[model samples]
Target: MKLFFAFAIIAIALSVVYGAPADPWNEYKTKHGKKFGSTAEDAQRKKLFLAKDALIAKHNSQPKASYQLEHNEFSDMTPAELSQYLGAVKPANKTRSLESMVRLEMETRQLPDSLDYRTDSCLPGVRNQKQCGSCWAFAAITPLEFARCKKHGALRAISEQQLVDCEPYDYGCGGGWYTNAWYYLQYEAGGAAKRSLYPYTATDNTCAFSSSMIGAKISSYGDLPSFDAAYMQSVLQDYGPISVAIAVTDSFFSYASGVYTDVECDDPNAYVNHAVVVVGWGTDNGIDYWIVRNSWGTKWGSAGYILMERGVNKCKIEKYPATILSVV
Candidate 1:
């Protein structure tokens, strides 16, 4: 019994000195279906996983934290590796000046205290963008899908790969702006192809666009003014979903739940690096937030969604709101 107790004490001391046991790492790997090419690779991944897990625990322990983090598919990835997921890039020159774009008139009536398009069945299931930086394509396609549902009474999965391949103004998976994608659909491609016909490859491929597979076409697209959450809500209610950009930080990669409000991402002029869809808005415990949809798959966030603090243009979310005006 004495010997057993001494061994146990040594084990505890070892854990305290080195870190926790490998049980959590093993379980995380299994949960995420993570596989490594070799033992060395596995060890490196485990180290990264442990470091991320510690950061998550530390952040969650803070009593005043507005959000939480957890081990998900990105848990084993390094910060540099995780950044590959962000693909939204700002255009060097606007296709049209922000002032020239049609803005939604502010609604005079009272907006709903809470709104969610997912409950309305207008939006489709969450999609995974994988390792490719094709978030701009995904973001651009979702609002079009929503508009189709609103206008035609049928929700259709349009091909994001079409934009990734055909849009000459934007750099396929390297990164892109949704407005440029819209311009391609409007003037160049004429229309978007159905997902069933032209599926997403998550890679830059030669344009294989066939006009015969056209599923949906937009008549016109417009941008909403920045720092106008009320107008954004009005547009969402009158129209459908709006494609917007946000400033993604290191903390954003591990976001699990709660209203995401980070000081680092609060700058109005902060570079918006990722594109997402704003499906709706609501107040949670007195804090207003936008129900933003992400393309990183259901394993991340609240089944591939994040509640961004609204009204304050949190993470530059309200900076560049663009949407299709009418579906054809």
Candidate 2:
């Protein structure tokens, strides 16, 4: 018994050093209601548990950080695996410059010191993207919804299903650009249908769009100057929400709450794999952040939203924001 105790103490010390705690099998199972089916399943579950424990430790190691991490459906996933689930695939061709697309006389306004569109009743409810890489579709359509709501005084959930299925310019569930989705909405589909009319299935299906069922129409879309938060703030105040692509990494996937600022994800040349809407911006504990609405369900972040680090363009969020012109 003395020898066993010594070994257990050593094990705990080693775990502390390595940042991976002993798997709390019972505790995890209790929290998630998860059960392993077989010996192989049990091994997989154990692996995931270790990964989760390591991530928890990593999160706790950061001192004075604004955010905290939580265990969720993605706890089991590696950064690569999480990338598969996000799927905001950008097009291979270079995107066109915003200067050529915007009308010369579009009205504009400046934001207050801080702004949150959701507070003004601009945004709708949180959405879940599921396993599809259709975050581009969700990010693209949400601003359209905001634009329509601002013009017509009624918030409507535009169909991402239409963009996911019908737009040939994009890769559908495999991946696509949010800007291409805007072009598709303006010219191809003539506008998107209501989500109630064509609910999301998280899979690519046949195009069921009809011109007669159009709920919102966008005349044009333009990009914010790359890496300009000041311009983005003005656009958000004058227009509505904007679509943005980000360099999603392991840290981003594990994010739960507070302002996220990761140097690894700050690489502008890093592949932009996930897309979301920039609905607002604010500061928390002197850490400036952009209030972004994610489509990973309300369980993922702070009610399906993330407070991303602002000013420095963490995760390259400031690089690819696009505004839409809605004709409600």
Candidate 3:
């Protein structure tokens, strides 16, 4: 009995000597205690950031990583720019533990969009390597076809580059408005091709319109009407992902992991440099969010699109469907 007691005592002492209580809350509060923002908006974001460490740590054991995908444009960056360049990297890990493949990490606006989906004219699927800003072209066309799939029942795949190289009024190589591109597709002849026809090259090259026979291409859906948030949601709900944008604040850049909230309503357009897609959304921890898909590649913002502040004007809007639509 004496020998057993001694061994037990030694084990207990060693355990106490090695493992100590860790209070992430105390450290977080202490480090950020004196940190104050310039205004109310700034102060809110500050609070959200301070809580970031704890939130990420809270779920560290069960870190959900089902956000992996191919072709991340933002790659090989320095730690200093991790937050800002989130629109660039694609995470190497892909987790399937979570039932869904995506999650929203920030609050977002839940307003309605006033546009239409044209399945015949929309892009087939998501494309990549538009570092050349040809994204203006790619992003614009996919939704057009999504509209078609919604009302017309046309499931044909449309090529965004086809509009870039062929569509008039809108320059295929340069960035342009999505609405205008649709106009060109309506009255233009040489502005059409299948996804397998033109393909994508991330690089900016002159319009090399061709007549390839890889994928199916359809005619435009005549003059359409403006859209509202409900309409966008209707189309998006029926389709898959829709491309959208939100104003990212300083906290957005500084954020490392976990849920994003209490963002500064300063510019209402902080991280306006990047673009992404709206995938899915649901509520957790009493906060509303929207799932977004980013084109900056992968390894950026939670996995692709970091959650934006939804509800209220935190993300600066109350619209549904949010931004552009994507049928492909």
Candidate 4:
């Protein structure tokens, strides 16, 4: 009896040291619906999971952390595996002239202090890109959907899969730019299909696009002023959601809540790796943040959204802002 009691005490102490339940590995797997092919694979994944859990705990424990980290669907993924979700590639011509692009005529009026297109019922439900590096497609499709809904008074889920399969310039799932996807919609595809017609397969498949399925068409698209947050804000207020690229760091995969501000994101030369939609902006406790929507589904972040630190151009968010002027 004494030996058994000692073992129990030891287990409790180990649990305390680990800062997790007695069988956190099992608990995590069960919670996330994880399955491993073999016991060895399971062990390897458990080690990775524990390490990530520890990092999350360490970051959240910080006294002045602007954001908090939490366990989610990505808790079991390695840094490399998490990176597979980032599909936004930088455009070859980083300094593409905006002269050919349509420009929004700014009105000399006070912009609202805060705005969220999600609440206006113009935006569609948050979607899961699901292991495919299709962030560009989601980012591009969302703003067009928003513009169409704003003008037509009906919300529709445009097909990201259409861009994934049909956009000749992009390498579907390998990585692509939202701008290229936008160009494809404007010219080649003639528009975009509805989600019902060409639902996301999350893979590089044969282009199954049909003209009858085209749900929305863009009249013109344009890039906002580089690093100009004020201009970006005005455009977002007038036009709707804007597609932009940002650097996705290690901490970004585990983001849970609060205004996300990472030191790595502040670097001017940081690689812009993921495309996301800027839905709105607001101030939280004197800290201004852009309300951004991600493509990782409702399970990630705050119901498939994140608040990024605004104005400082954190994560190069204002670098490649693009928006659809009108949808037919």
Candidate 5:
């Protein structure tokens, strides 16, 4: 009995020390999972991640994970290239993970064949949905904003928060897709609450009318091609960056800094992550990379983005592409 009591005390102490481990990732799941899947089951994958050293020992040959900056673009790029491409690096720039990956993106000129995964309304604050678990709305609606700009020759930030608050016709905050969001906005007569009108609070709430609210008449592209590398590249080359979803890497959790290539060792199962935006692609130092935007806020990653390898292109946006737009 005494031994059991001691073990119980140790367990309680560890819990307090580590803080509540109630899947601290739950908050992460709700926000990022929106576009990845309707249910958390799709967005998250289970994996037993061993420590870096342990992983090396298990793999025996050393997985060749580049955690340090021996070849990162920021460290390797010349001053002229840095000035033209990256400008001057600040102290904070030293720690960004996607820095090396973006070098490949900057050189790419490939454009998609047509507009896709974009909307007429180009809104900001993808991070706001983290609380609401409304990532799909952000993912689905963003393409609309960019597409409309290209189609109409105009530029403006739309509102994802408005979608969160105004579209009571859908699943509220639990989660919904961009296709459904487009339908919701279209049915609401093309007037969606703008960011100022209905900002993202991350909580499920009632949709109240606001005067300043403005949004595009949500439209569809018939049926978008499956979300894949070929499709994503084609869209970017022709239209622009396509808002997309994919399996996020769990090492994305340990990603304090450094460019992420396939060489970066991580749990594959944990990589089934969801995200929005496919900026562009290119090659640097003879390696291919994909430029991607993220909603985790600029402070969290490569200025709220990441560089994925072109060959590593995986994941399929479940639904067809949709977009956000300006109502007036």
Candidate 6:
């Protein structure tokens, strides 16, 4: 009887030391099925849990306004671990080319107060860049897909794997630039093949992009004026989605939903680590915001989307908006 009582007490103490009876990562584990392989890994996971709990407590204690954070798979990862998973790096300047001479009629058109490309069937279904640092490829491909659909009346899934394998100038999964990917599609690949023809392996593989499978082509690609919200709106109103690279931080990864203001990672140009697509812009609770779509899958963010603070170049999104003229 005494041994039984002592065992119960020890179990309770262990529960207290480890965590509350309710495991916070239960949902994440169930969805991802990620488990620690060794004792060292287990210890790291515990440390991640503590770190995540601290972040959660800090977020919850603050008054609900601007944005909110949620504990997800990234919560268990350290900043360095997260960065390895984030593969989109700023492209080399020599490789960066944008044709500024061509006139886009959209730039001269009157823009709406708000525009969402998804509403106009310009945006395609959300994609998961699972375990691949190929966000640069995905972000670049999104605009082309939408632009092709806008012009040809048929939405086609362009292959990011084609860029991953075939783009001679850019690194495959390690990291690359949206602009570089765009240039590759325009010049090297001679327009990208459909995903069905060149499915994404999320890893570097041999280039098998066949011209016979090519379903879409890019006539030209250009960059929007830096920090110009009006020009951005006009372009989005006409061109559909645009590719953007943003400097993300510890807090940004923890983001679940809300109009993310510049309160956290205020330095948008600190490091253009992650590439995403800006489909539209609007206001939330009086806060101006840019509608950003991420490649972290539909399970993350607001159904694979986030509302970033607008007009201030939040995360350098306004600084480097790249898009292409597409046709099928």
Task: Point to the candidate with the largest lDDT.
Answer: 1
Query: Can you give the TM-score per candidate against the true fold?
Result: 0.91, 0.86, 0.49, 0.91, 0.55, 0.88
Worst 10 residues of 4 by lDDT: 94-103
TM-score of predicted structure 5:
0.55
* Cα lDDT listed for each candidate: 0.88, 0.80, 0.43, 0.87, 0.46, 0.79
lDDT of 3: 0.43
Pairwise TM-score winner, candidates 1 and 5: 1
Segments of candidate 1 deviating more than 4 angstroms: 1-22, 96-100, 267-269
**How does candidate 3 fare on TM-score?**
0.49
Count of clashing pairs, candidate 4 = 0
Worst 10 residues of 2 by lDDT: 97-106
Give the per-residue lDDT of model 5 (tens digit) for 1-328: 9999999999999989997666523443454442334444433322221233244234333355433211111222233322221111111232221121111122345554333222224434335344345666666556666666666666546667666666654454555445455555665536455555556666666666564566454443322344345644654655555655554433443333334553333334423234366666656555555665665555545555565556454333322232232233
Over the stretch 1-328, how does candidate 2's per-residue lDDT look in tens digits?
Answer: 9999999999999988896854476666777677767988777867876877787778767797678887777776555567656777766675442322564243455557688876667588889988888999899888888888888888888899998899887777888888888877776677788888888999999988888778888877777777878778877777878899888877677678888876788664577889999998998889888999999998887888899988787888987788786564
Candidate 4, 125-181: lDDT as tens digits: 899998999999999999898899888999888899998899988789988988788
Taking the tens digit of each residue's C-alpha lDDT, what string does model 1 give over 1-328? 9999999999999999998866998898888899999999999999998898898999999998888998888888887788789988898888442322576666577898988987777799999988888999999999999888889998899999999888987788888989888888877789999999999988999989999999999888889888888888988988888999889987898999999988888764568889999999998778899999999999899999999999988998988998888989
**Candidate 4: lDDT of 87?**
93
* Model 6 per-residue lDDT tens digits across residues 64-101: 65788777777777666787556777756633455322
lDDT of 4 at 47: 83
What is the overall TM-score of model 1 with all chains considered together? 0.91
lDDT of 3 by residue, 137-157 (tens): 544455554555555566555
lDDT of 5 at 214: 67
